[model samples]
Target: MRYDGSNELHARQARAKLEKLIKDKKIFDLTEKKPQRSIQANKYLHVCLSYFGCQIGETMEYVKRNYYKILCNPDTFIREREDKYLGRVKYLRSSSELDSSEFSLTVDRFRNWCSSNAGVYIPSPDEERLIQLMELEIERNKEFI
Candidate 1:
């Protein structure tokens, strides 16, 4: 269920569809009034990353460290550096991009990554539900696109 990023149109369509699902789920209203970098925001990001296999094993501590850095100045450290620091191979999008898009792409990328890497790890039932929702949305809307 990995999104075909090579197909730009399909990728954009998938992203738009996921964005709508996220808003409908009220996953973290990034409305103008909301503080973009609050504790709540970090918690939301943390949960999302955790669900996407970013916090496996000892990666939680690394995620937390970079998460704080992202909270402070997302534009400074690029995604490449973040991946290196996390000891992962490009598992995350740039903090600047996430900040600029209000984390819309972050959600899409995480979903895409998880879908392609399924069976690598087993998520909890609760996490599975969230992933399924996203996957269902993608599958249902992708046809319409």
Candidate 2:
């Protein structure tokens, strides 16, 4: 059974059920949930991505789809075929599902991949000047959004 902890009442009910199950000696594994990436992390990631995309004369969407989504995290893509058309399709798992550490690793991989393969050195958020310039450039372009 899948347990959702978003709802207070449901979470309490699920905990009670789990306690009873434990008492009944049913084997189970329980793990604590990790925090997801913060808003600042997300913003920094996008800023770097948009900057790199602009440098390469590509749209942010194009860079995100090809470079970050496909390359850095290929495992998240699910392949399926349509029964009626028999055409293959792919669905990407949302990055929002990733925990803070997982998201940070993914971002690091993207940065490394960009530098090694694309020869584009994306500045870190710590490089405040470059980051601000990139943000301004993206704002001017409008397509970076």
Candidate 3:
């Protein structure tokens, strides 16, 4: 159940319900559910990564892991796991977890970093040139899709 936290009456009603549940020994969990990243933004990210990969002579996965995530957006994707044989394992948080704005920020940081660090001039997602490039790539590489 959801109620507007800002509205006093709604908040009181939700609090009373939660209190009743607690008194009755009911178990529940709560979390905020934000909208996931946009499909268009995801497509732009892949296009940017693919172009950067071509420029740097590496695959998109390599570029995304080494350059984009590590260099541009450091310390944003840390995760941990426990294994029976290997003990504790630390890994990256998946990019899919980021909401639309966070993902866009990461992409922008990657482009800016590429320009300054690697001398690769990646266009911003909204640029007309980038759109053209995306369309051109899709038309040429139909098999990859």
Candidate 4:
């Protein structure tokens, strides 16, 4: 199935919700154990690597080669990837909010590239769980808020 506008819309909505939760400080209580920055970064990297059809070894190699660059300036890495793999889409803006069409195009291109180059399909479960876990965490912390 091709990525479409609806998918982009949904992703934006979910991202907005998460951002709102974060802004409201409703997702985590300071008194409790908080999610680690490394964990969050790893989860995000996993999702991005999955989109690119990078297996564990490939992902590790990518991190090894680009970790410092990513840490120092993530937008550069994102822009490089977009320029390399997604010519059809406009460059990603620094703003957190993404244009739906651009987002859809990025996803489509990544999936297509991954399938053709790596012979691997994107697995939905991990991405789904990642979002779900955030939502659940927010829900669980609602009372504290």
The prediction achieving the highest TM-score against the true structure is 3
- The 10-residue segment of model 4 with minimum total lDDT is 28-37
In the range 22-112, model 4's lDDT, one tens digit per residue, is 9887854323222233445445434545333224334433532343223323443345334556565434234123344443344455445
What are the lDDT scores of the predictions, listed in order? Answer: 0.47, 0.79, 0.79, 0.44
**Tens-digit lDDT track of model 2 for 49-143:** 78878878888877788888888768654445565575676677667778887777778888998889899887776888978888898888775
- List TM-score per model, in order: 0.31, 0.66, 0.72, 0.30
Superposed model 2: Cα runs more than 4 Å off: 1-33, 76-89, 143-145
**22-136, model 1: which lDDT tens digit per residue?**
8788554322233245554455555544433332432433543454334333444435533536664433444433453555444444444444554333233257576565445
Question: TM-score for model 1?
Answer: 0.31
Candidate 3 — which pairs collide?
A: 77-93
Worst lDDT run of 10 residues, candidate 2, spans 75-84
For all candidates, the clash counts are 0, 0, 1, 0
Q: What is the lDDT of residue 134 in candidate 3?
A: 58
RMSD of every candidate to native, in Å, equals 18.4, 6.4, 3.1, 17.6
Q: lDDT per residue, candidate 3, 41-132, as tens digits? A: 88878888877777667777888888888778876766678989999997877799898778878888898998999998787766977667
- In terms of lDDT, model 4 sits at 0.44
Tell me how many residue pairs clash in candidate 4.
0
Global CA lDDT computed for model 2: 0.79
